[model samples]
Target: MTQNIIRWAQMDDIHDLAYVYSESYRKAYVGIIPDEFLDQVSLNERDQYFRKSLSEDKQKIAIMSLDEKAIGLLIFDFQGEADLPENSAEILAIYLMKDYWGSGFGKLFLNWGMDRINELGYANVFLGF
Candidate 1:
């Protein structure tokens, strides 16, 4: 059986995390987002973004793995959009490799994020995408 796990993302994870992000986006948003924009996405840019996110106190990013190989990424925070309730938390991003789709990992990750949000004392949560 696969040893599925979710843990706080670390600096070393930026490379694999960025690959998952870029591939997942390229697969899911091909038409919705301009191909040119998606094509321009790079691991270096994502690495820098992850670095910045890790520096912020408000951000909580996690990595999901199976048998020690990372397969997904999750990012959430207490900050809400202007249209959302002030006390609500937001799921900034969530992504899993295409191979892992429909295998219940997404549900597991969502539940984990919700549990974290509830633990943080937030009564409501919103997922950005």
Candidate 2:
């Protein structure tokens, strides 16, 4: 499979980002949450909120494809300052486009983010099942 290189999201990606935002979201959180609740969600809101979070969350990141495609993303940690004295962390979300699920991008992106976290002084990272 061709490797899709990941890069930090930019303003030009809002549209594709929104598409992947909803698509991957429908696959990941739709069933766990409720349909009506899911229907009420706004990708724009999530984008805006996460944009600010990314700007501020030094421990957090949002990545996309080099060709403006958003196949998947990995966001780690919370809203407040990280208190992990040992630098243990949580991978809040790491979702792939449904078509790319077993295509190796998942593993590639996961390890990429783990490497980032470790470079940021983290000893461990946790991903939600």
Best by TM-score: 1
- Off by more than 4 A, model 1: none
lDDT of 2 by residue, 70-99 (tens): 788777773334554444778877778888
Instruction: For candidate 1, write residues 1-129 as lDDT tens digits.
Output: 869988888878888888888888788787899988988888888888888887765688989999988889999877777899879888989999999989999999988878888988998888786
Query: Global CA lDDT of candidate 2, please?
Result: 0.69
Clash count of each predicted structure: 0, 0
- Candidate number of the best lDDT: 1
Go through the candidates in order and give each one's C-alpha lDDT.
Answer: 0.85, 0.69
* Model 2 bad stretches (over 4 Å): 1-3, 11-14, 78-85
